[model samples]
Target: MAPAKATNVVRLLLGSTALWLSQLSAGTVAASKSVTAHLAAKWPETPLLLEASEFMAEESNEKFWQFLETVQELAIYKQTESDYSYYNLILKKAGQFLDNLHINLLKFAFSIRAYSPAIQMFQQIAADEPPPDGCNAFVVIHKKHTCKINEIKKLLKKAASRTRPYLFKGDHKFPTNKENLPVVILYAEMGTRTFSAFHKVLSEKAQNEEILYVLRHYIQKPSSRKMYLSGYGVELAIKSTEYKALDDTQVKTVTNTTVEDETETNEVQGFLFGKLKEIYSDLRDNLTAFQKYLTESNKQMTPLKVWELQDLSFQAASQIMSTPVYDAIKLMKDISQNFPIKARSLTRIAVNQHMREEIKENQKYIPEFLPR
Candidate 1:
């Protein structure tokens, strides 16, 4: 039952889609899964994660219909579908808006299908209506950058008028960051699913230099982070924004949901949870592995050392280049012990006497000759 509560976003997503999802075959979901995931990465601003699913991989559309049909008694859930259906959301950025650490945080922490944002794509989902309550967004900022709180509030008002024309719905109740670090947070009760599908890896990573701030807000209960004063690592400086918090009931009419729940079949629910975590883990691990390789490469830049000898003719430069080039490569290996792929690829493509001699030397060194 408690887990059912976790499905608040799940309810909103499934409840609203009850109409359309019922009309399609389960295979439609299966076919669209990879397509939408790929697209979500491309268009983080489009809220594809909140829409027609990307969430539609299961064969349980009948049960979703059944849940809406049966759970009509739960009045709070009646309108929970709009966060998904309303495609064009008002996203007003705060802080050095140029760097949107906040938007990325929201995407990673929820069931939404958003990736890092350059967020210009507009074709993912479409909406023709204004926000339900006339205005439907809260003030968001990097909590670490609120030194000029008064100025930011002024900016918020200006942002509401001059910017993308979304409604600003809440009074600021700046959240306390438990970690004492700097984080971009939504002060409003956006009610992101308690633990994002990727929270497991994000959580594990948080312990290690804890790059991720464990995003733990459930449906209806808005939560925030503890952040540092500067960009990162230090404790967050909490200053009172002195504005009132938004009314909890305001979200009562705000509807959203995830794809895992009793509303779907048991197989669907289990797979939704397990599959998302597994896929998310692989994504995170692969990223880390790539980073490892990148670091191992030590980001070495192969300088055009020959350029320094520009006055020399091409033939003269080419003649002495062998010894210097050999020296440079050997020095790089001695220092970093890892050859970047580009260097390796280039070496393999054009192996020379220097390379051949070095390989033979390495083989000879590995089994050193006995002292006479």
Candidate 2:
């Protein structure tokens, strides 16, 4: 009787293990196919504005400004309507202008790879450059400017305080205060610099996750691709050693090792290990590919890297925010504060609020201009 029962138990365990393994393989295969499809679709269709340098070579300043205004309007419309088609048109036009010399040259100056050409293209369209006096309506980076860093900091703090409760509650209200406008404007105009500053904090030994949380609140409604691409640049700076501390390698390895035994515990561990190994492998491959991409692409890749990081973060945030969870709110808040805007900080804040609402209401995800 005992031998018969033992045999039965072993059979059951083996059956269960087989089932689990099948599911794991199926899942892995599906995920890979999905990622491949996404890349194939996005890469082929995306306007390679950086490489197509001649598109906007001789566009007049007035025309450039008109294009930029249209881009801004399209971005705003996309935000309001959550429409993918309009955004796609915006990208087509924006890509053309960004490839222009005046617009894209600044991209080379900054270590940023992806959006410099876009910025330079916009610059060329403006009749004027960054105010020679270095005093914009938002931020004062000039030696002649008399605004105190403390004052700017105070304004940021106030804006953050005003927006925090609403960000979590899905009841966002835009700031109308005159002083607060500068803070928002600064964020819009210097988004890259703000982004760098935000990550610089994350890169610090004593990084404050709360600050990142604040900035995220304002930028949360933007497409997921933007966030995903944004973080890739800083991720390059994070060491494997630091990541290893965040991961449990020994347990993962043990789980990955195939279990010859026909038992429940062994089956569970093996299943877990397989999943972890797959994740580890994918990340390793991504990093390897990224390095290769950088070496081959050279300076042009800088803007691409920045955009990639933003897209990564954007994708992650979109999922989190869709759930309307507390972590999502915290993340949104942090993003809002972290990435300083060069032009439209208030707009970003408004967009974040709108996204939060859509997420809470289970709105459908809109396809972005780049089709990611």
Candidate 3:
């Protein structure tokens, strides 16, 4: 009788628990539905964009941007009356808030890989008439210019080499097409220095004199320019396939090493360190030469500070050297007596560690670029 009473008590508890869970689940579903309905009413296009954001959260920024751009382009093509306003509002808010939603929208819209959408977004953002001198506006304009150049190059490949350039007859008809107009505005607003380097490239490849003239006119246009400009040339230089090749080689060599063969492991480590040392030496030499040239010629190009150069050099070296360097340093510390060149290796390790810290410190000072 006592056992039966306990079982009845257990059944009652289980029934109550099940009922509570059912109520909780129902409440959650109702809350979610209500939120969705609210979002739909407040921003008619936001629900789909939010859904896209969730789907793309784990993907690369480029892929996410591509997807968002595709959605935007499709909306435009479909002539959805409300979508243009909706998208503009979203972009405006993004620029204003600079929050997760803003970042995600940009990551989905302005990736270097998604050229067309990047351009479109740039144009849209530019059209919002954000202060021309504002940092965010400058970044968007610069990216727009890059996209325009890339797009023009792509189109030029399909166009006849000798095709006549569109003529400008002073009737508000600049040679600038819909695609190139943003670039023109960027140059007009940002000044000649923004595109001075690319002018030569444009001149060399432009299909005709008229095209070249139009490009030159925009690129050389003078304006009240912002004082500071972000330099991406070094970053671009280090992002080549060559760095990836080195990384792959380093990985393979390390992975193929067996713990049983201490000599082979040491040999691999030695080889890697040798390569790293060579790269570091080359970079130091190049930096010295560049500094010398800058001082001698008094070129208008902004000179990199010594620490900046060191940071860049360390970053470049780390691409191929970080893993092997780390392992070698660890091994030496573990068995200092057995390690060859113990003192020198320790010094190198210290330097590398310090440089790593400096790089982290410098990142805080660096301006936030869109892709970052």
Candidate 4:
């Protein structure tokens, strides 16, 4: 490890070891299968892991807002009996967008070569320290504790989490009768987690005598934010996924006296796409509910939160409150009230603009236009 990374390891080891051990001790059977990470986020209710979720959770959710932005107006011209027609159209298009993103970015989870940063980190740190007197092909994170790494998964976890070890054994049978096969499992968030949570389940499954070697990884957030999507509360869930299994060619037993670094060249990208699909589905459900709410004229709806009200939603609400139908002056006055805050934010963006910025002011990537 580099000096900076070494320093980070030193700090974490010195400062966080106690905290880590305490959390490990505190988890009950069910709670043990879950880890929690608070990555610059605050959720009001359930701390479900999409139930065994991960990041890009925020980044994926942000697409909901972006999807709203691209459409200039709703498609229906006040003639549809089905309130969900517009919502369904948006959902369908959003699904297309999600698919496009996946094909372009996230297909790597199934790639032949494995790439999991968290497991690498865990193993690296373990190598730096200790792994017991003799053990084949597995790092001992803690020598004091028992490691249960085989068995049927009835199962899954939550934690301050990490890198994707989205690997599988390719020749999986329907009965999945492959005995003693090593399985790589990863649980990560944008913040902390523990591989130990998986122990109880794996140990229980092992006792049943149907077993495979398990390589479990629990990770915290990475330095990079590339995987996640962020917008508002509108998009807030990660779809769960299990990656493709490794074929015989991809898995070769190695001895200590060999240089295997040359084969570690392939890169995996966008293992985070399923998380986006989960978020979009969640958003679609919300829009479906919103459409149903619109269908009823006498329904007294709950007041919308500021986070729930987007610029367009605010515009629509303003239009509905107009003195006369489609009054021009009222619309102008309603929208103009936002000028003060928008101007301040725009000024900040302007001040931060570099003389030689990579993306130009009118670039299609963002296509942001400031009001003069």
Candidate 5:
């Protein structure tokens, strides 16, 4: 064959190969997007428990699993890219896709916990070893700041002075603005959950903003506002949105069994979920220690009894409703309610005036005003 003709043939073959490669890549991309869309559609169909269910009927079907695998694989591809811009583009797309699908996922989780025993899916995912084929599909193993709830409480204590804007001021020391107090209290509650490795991923300001959003709703009621200012809102707030999101996220990483075909990524996710679950279980077991820290923190911040304060205190309470001191007060109140405590000896009990009046009315055996 002539050298020039042979070279032309080689070029022709190369062109054909490139065309075939491009076609395959395009098909993969389309498939990925389709899978993501389908998962989004199917996610809302069941509660999380059913989604995470061991029973075949309760579980997400093979189609949804395939979608998750594609996303997970794309995530791995992004991670493997050394080019920061390219990698980030992949990550951003993955994040947006995941965020859109979050609602359906969350609904399933919360609802299913009621119908079935809480399976430690995160633990299971975390426990699963990666397969050798470069795909395990569900783990994202990044190091997370794993702090105890008490440690988080301490961090908040250190940051108390910075929390001034969230407080309400009035005639008394540490008074809170009632209207704003509930939101701030809820914000504080939300803050507690962010102490772990999962939440440590966000900047402090961003994290605070997220908490504030959640806190805004929990404090809407007069009872809730009063509850917040009277020091009952703190723990409730923590249990409410702030920490709950963190807890829920932690649970999600594991229980959702939505792994991709990349071993490293799957391992990372599994590790994070496993760590989060460990942290959550640890917090649950150390509730007593947390309670002790709560008592001490409250004593240091506000020593006034709930009955001794006037409506003026509400201003102070409201202002600092997001403060660690407020959280301390809420903790004491929660303990008093749940643990069959002697109410007379509760520590750092700073009740706002509205609560005081309610107590007074209650003492007279007047019926509590139930909100319509």
Candidate 6:
């Protein structure tokens, strides 16, 4: 079907359902019967409008599940052309049914790129008026103050010259506006070599403005750390030796490490571990909240389906947390070797135990409906 026709069908269905539900809510028996008959005759195969009316007539968990299932099925069928209004309607109704469901639905809507409905839903839930059109908000990643503006501009010019072949072909100057300034700095910091990795993913015809937007979004969200670790991390990890290996006398003289040095090493190790634990705790909390939302709507989801979504979230969190976990392990190992701490073995064991507990906690977020 054409996109317009499909949209019309959805609008008509929603309008009919709303009218029927409103009448049912007011306890107008005649009006309710009249709307139901009209919707039944209009959409014979799909009785969703009438079902929604019945759900409004007597709200219950079972009825709510039926309504959600019907909406889910409709959404699946309407996935073509990326039309998401149907899903948005389901989310809107889901919000009305439960607060958590509403928030999750908003998340789901954004995931599917249903920006319009998601924005509308957010305004309604937030109880705030909408911002004027063309309004924009952004997050900035602070940069070190060591480099002067002119030096940074020169670096950006060099970076742009190198990146132009891969990103855009023609000559173009970076925008001077505040909105795009951070993006330019990020691109400059990324350099040509690192930005080349994105060449395959980015289209040849993509404009500089589009690239700027993409970079801004990436810097703000940074959903996956693997890309950075694999690309930029590897580049930065290459060691540059300033001098030859130390002689025996130099090594022997450095061996006279102090008690204060050892204490400082322990403190650094403790700080690294503490930060790792905090990241783990946040991942656990997010998973737990999502799991609770899933469990509450268990009647509407299959075990396999639940596990699929749960696994996706787990993998994303794990990917993001992987860098910190590695850093902590490396810090512990480095500190253990440098200091004469007798608790090195015990600390290793404790770190392993903490990681095990974190992984176990992550597993708890998967709904019990999935296989054990």
Question: Could you report the Cα RMSD, in angstroms, for every candidate shown?
Answer: 32.8, 35.6, 26.3, 37.2, 36.7, 35.0
User: How many clashes in candidate 5?
Assistant: 43
> Which candidate model has the greater lDDT, 3 or 4?
3
- Could you tell me how far off, in angstroms, the CA of residue 312 lies in candidate 6 after the best superposition? 59
Q: Which 10-residue window of candidate 3 scores lowest in summed lDDT? A: 36-45
lDDT, candidate 5, at 290: 45
Residues 232-330, model 2: lDDT tens digits: 323223335543344579766565443211111111201333244356765644543443343233323222335344334444455445433645665
Give per-residue lDDT, candidate 4, residue 114.
20
Candidate with best lDDT: 3
Task: Provide the lDDT at 136 for model 4.
Answer: 25
State in Å the error of residue 350, model 4.
48
Off by over 4 Å in 5: 1-30, 33-333, 341-362, 365-372
| C-alpha lDDT values of all predictions | 0.32, 0.35, 0.38, 0.34, 0.33, 0.35
lDDT of 1 by residue, 64-132 (tens): 222222222232332464643332222221112213564455433333332212112112111122112
Instruction: Give Cα distance to truth, residue 83, candidate 1, Å.
Output: 21
What's model 5's lDDT at 360?
Answer: 62
What is candidate 1's local distance difference test score?
0.32
Task: Give the Cα-based TM-score of candidate 4 against the true structure.
Answer: 0.16
Residue 316 displacement in candidate 3 (angstroms): 90
Residue range 1-372, candidate 6, lDDT tens digits: 699999999999999999999978888766565321111111112222222322322345344333433443342333352435654554455455556754564454344333322222322322222222332211112321111223433343344334322222211223223333223322210112223333222212133333332221111111231211111112224466788766888665465233223322232222333344356766644543443343334324223444344334333333234445645665546534633332222232222345557878868987775886
TM-score of each: 0.16, 0.21, 0.18, 0.16, 0.17, 0.17
- Top candidate when judged by TM-score against the true structure: 2
Instruction: Pick the winner on lDDT between candidates 4 and 6.
Output: 6
